[model samples]
Target: MDSFSGSSRGGFAPRGGRGARGRGGRAPFLTKTRETNPDLEKHPLGCLIKEFGSPDLGLNPVDLAKISDCQYVASYNWLNDEVPTIVIPGKPPQWTPLQEPQRLKEDSGQYFRDPNAAMYPDYPMAPVVNAVLETDSEFDAARTDVFACGSTLGNLLRFARGIDKAFRFNVVVIGDTVFFMRKDNDPREVIKDVRGFGHTFPEAYTTWEHSVKGSETHQRIIRYKFGGFSCLVRFESDGYIPDSSAVTNTTPANTAVGQGDLFQAFQGATISQQPTINKLGSLKIKQGGSPVPQKSIFDLKTRSGKYKKDIDMSDILPQLWINQIPNFIVAYHDGRGLFEDIRVRDVSDDVQAWVTDNSDGIRRFATLLDKIVDIARSNSDKLLEVYCPGKEHLEVREQYGDGAHALPADLRDGLDGSKDGDGGDISDGDEYYDSDEYGFDNRSDDSSEELDYTACSAHDCGYCGKCTY
Candidate 1:
């Protein structure tokens, strides 16, 4: 078999249609800068060079992306391209390079994994602590949980926050598990590995457990010290069931732990939901059922069970804010004076930049809060007696019924806003909401707090009152 190697050895007369034509019926020349990827240019160039047996191969460069499969073959190496040149009989040699095809650059936002990648990061991007979950498992360590994917860090935070909206929580990337431990592996040494989070494991939760192969397995939940007024949720393998060996398959870990279903079999007791939190920080029944609805923030479906695949929560928050706040400007700056300003229509850019610059801070903040919450809960079991504010309490006595926190009238035409008698006229894509008709007492209540709603529609906000607005 002839080696596919393109050689400096053979030469053949150029055939018609082999090279693209120029405006004046000549062989078009290619410059190095003609292609963004040098490899794209080199592969075709090498093929032409080998086909015609010349180092000085000239043809249309822009036609690289347009080259048919039969005309081009990719190189395995950087430039030692191997290609077989076939000569067609009776075709006259003629050459003129083709014009460069116009191509648009891909949006850089596709690379960001931050949930708020569509919004502003709480802090700047420089202080990001990449808390990677490291394990010594015989199989790949990352397969233990989705959070191990690194890309799902933001999703972890969002899920944790949504689980309990009453208080902020930090996510402790629970490192190393039983699967990663050898019989000779010291549990204490494994516990020490929690230092990767820049904190020492708490003496109390030095041990944890897991459920694998339909059996309850013991493991360690490395609790590190976290401070501040929030809760700590361990992102561990308590509910993670390995579908297969990570060594054999490099699939991401899928958790059996549903959102908001915490403490099924972990060290920490489940934070019980209280009907009404008293001033003394105790749960006191407030008679009728709690007003706040319970639902998952990560659920991509509507209340009607319609899933909007294109709508990502990260992308929705900014749009919701834009709808309410007029004259909003989304801006991006990279310290290099490359300032890109976008309006509401192109607001996605602003969110992407914010996420890129601040994902580290958000993750760290969640971790720190988790540590603090963990320590507090350990020291005082009383802290566990948390008062669920019975959904988010609106101190404001609005005549508009409790639906004051409902979706915008226009967006809620046939939804909650509609049921509340505030349905607006949806004509020509314009909606009008009447405060008087809808029961909203626009008259500012000196006592009322801000409105709270996940969508500008309806669903049970699982969080006590962590509405987006």
Candidate 2:
């Protein structure tokens, strides 16, 4: 990662562009307020807390050989509807290369809604687990050590290396798999307002290419082994390229879902139930689209070309490495929304080199994961919250209130043979502690007061709340 250069407050210098605004300029963007579950805030701090300790970075270099090949496990799409609709093995947006320069619209409207919660309102992680079981019924949940999203793992990696801003996530142990659930105030809460072509460029670039059109987002699940632990990671894919061979051989018949059997049961359904009527909540499962190999999937970014600024691969390699995404697309616009320079590069080598060079940090990251898992497992409640105030040590505390479960009662029971069947109701736990016992200070309101608006931009710091932009 590039070194941050700027104020003593740890804010980085603004990368030059039309969107650059100093401290007194217009606000970059802000998270929208929405009515969320009041219980979310009511979840109290717990007495049992584990402080994040630095691991010896010099010892036990991570075994790169142990990093298993990423396998395509399952996928789903969030359909645009009043109710969340999910299609299994749902198609990702096809990477249709642009032919000419075009003036794209400035991004407008809600930008960062949590697709997981929007699609499966009851349980965010349920769809991934459901899709995994639906794809491979024999999958051994016992052997899987960690189940996480790219965002949570990335936060952990940054925290282990002491490079990230403060973040919080919930951890739940289902069978042997410790799920790191990304917790936000509201699943539908707007993360930020649109300000640039980051959203619009992709809109003009990719095509849905399948019957599952009007899909809001595409999410994929992949399984791999890292540092001797089997990890199942779920990430949102930007888009995908069509395999030439598959495109040539695929016929309309192979890609079409039978009219009579389109919507199938996602929960507890076998392959034979390809067209079953069992519905899991408001989620509608439909199978379509041919599977695209991992190599064809890509991550994309749009940058300003006014200053001839190049897209920094270093800033994004960590994300690609975590997801094992091989391709990257960078579109450079001429400040006025006209993009003429677009490059699609296969970054597999660059990502590999980054892994080798960052071996020390990677080892520490692996160690951090081990420590977190151990802490969660040792907890009597088997539910914990990982919280880090900006530039501070991590706190693994007992879950708030009657802790929330990662999956519904049926899914939880099916996952680990646990029959504490409450149908996914938030139950109050006996463990509770005063915040002062752990010296916990509420700093949530401090971010806005300390933000350096001039030094912040969506491309650079993502309005991380600490540095006002």
Candidate 3:
């Protein structure tokens, strides 16, 4: 949470021999100075903090404190030049030389030199969210309440509450379904990316913002589930929820296929017919009819006697369904806006439909990809009809229509001109909701430009003079 200082600005000169130790025997290098950059402070993020100040969002400090005390077998502290240490609580920590310390040192040295590379003490994603919820408060009431409600971020809170919480980014739950929110590293980068969603979702350009406000929002959302890929690790609390299907018990145990065979058989099954792992041979159940199949399934090898790589049925089955939840949510909610519809039943229905139709392509096609391509081909026209206008911009354009282009000369500035009402900026502050940084920024592009139309046909001449006028 420290504002990075300039290279020339005075900072704690690295403690000459050993780093300074503080309370609980932690490093002082983690200490942040009050130095603030005028330019950075002027940035939207800084301005918001100044205007809003920090408000307590009802999260607990103890939740975040638990992270620092969580047992980590191996600790990699870059602030200290000491070799990676083996951390055993109560015993003096022991350091081990890296296999190629020179390479590590060189790479890390250059990374630390980068101006944008701010140092963050190693910690799981959960505590960061908890800390932010408890401290930083700037988002709108609707957005802030999502986290304050607790249930919205319950799964994530669960992950962070545990010791050694596994880190997963962009994972969110809408209703009964949990989804991995897809996003580019940068929206500007997406504009330049030839294979980006910009073409499919032309309005996606405004999705990323480049300002400090955008940066802070991006950081908070990632901690609160926005962009970046997620890992579906096993937590003792809950298990993966895939579509329900009957497990055939008629198959003979002697003739049953091994885990390797089962995976191979179902690996290619359409997303709809994901392997309904009803049996695991000797690994099926525990003493009192409890299920513990991870170790056995992970140990299974391929038919050629090679260990199955990342093709484990255990993770793949759940992932097959887990990964698709977002798509269902997007298709159902995106016309309105991503995560805009937080209602559980609406979101859950979309998920159930997705699982029924896409998971086991038998309901539709052989695979989810095929279903998507087919749907796109079928709805290609409808998709083109929709434009990616910001919520405010779209309203303005709709009100004015084509005449919007030739609205009164004074009203030409789009929103600024109309006296009655123009779609106001999405958020407070001049930082337009940049699409480049994180989740949907409330603001829209200020510049007046014709909305880009995505077309699937060469026969119609709507805007461009290709086929017919």
Indicate which candidate wins on lDDT: 2
Cα lDDT over the full model 3: 0.17
Q: Which model, 2 or 3, shows the larger TM-score?
A: 2
Off by over 4 Å in 1: 1-212, 216-220, 223-384, 388-469
lDDT at 96 for candidate 3? 13
Q: Candidate 3 on 212-300: residue-level lDDT in tens?
A: 11010011121121111121221110011121121111111222234433332222111111101111111100001012122111100
lDDT of 1 by residue, 1-469 (tens): 1111000000001111111100000000111111111122211111110011111112212222110111100000000001111010001111110111111111110111111111112210100110111111122222222111111222223332232212111111222111100000111111100000000001011111110111111111111211221111111111111221211111122322332222221211111111111121111110110010011001111110022111123433322221111111121212121212211122333344443544443344344223333433343212111111122310111111121111123222322122223222222222121222112122211111221111111111211111121
Worst 10 residues of 3 by lDDT: 103-112
- lDDT by residue (1-469, candidate 2, tens digit) is 2221111100111111211101111112212212122233544566557885444323334574236767998887655544445556666766554444556655443323355664455688877876666566556688788999876887777776667466677899876778998776554434343354555555555656435444556778998988677899988777775542333211212222233221221110111111111223644444544456788887666666666545445546777788888876666677667877766667777778887877777888887787788887777366788886644577888776677789877666556634234423212221111122122122211002322221113222333111111
Which 10 consecutive residues of model 2 have the lowest summed lDDT? 266-275
Error of 2 at 53 (Å): 3.2
User: Which has the greatest TM-score?
Assistant: 2
TM-score of each: 0.17, 0.73, 0.17
Please list the C-alpha lDDT of all candidates, in the order they appear: 0.17, 0.55, 0.17
Query: In model 3, where do residues sit more than 4 Å from their true spots?
Result: 1-121, 130-132, 135-204, 209-350, 354-469
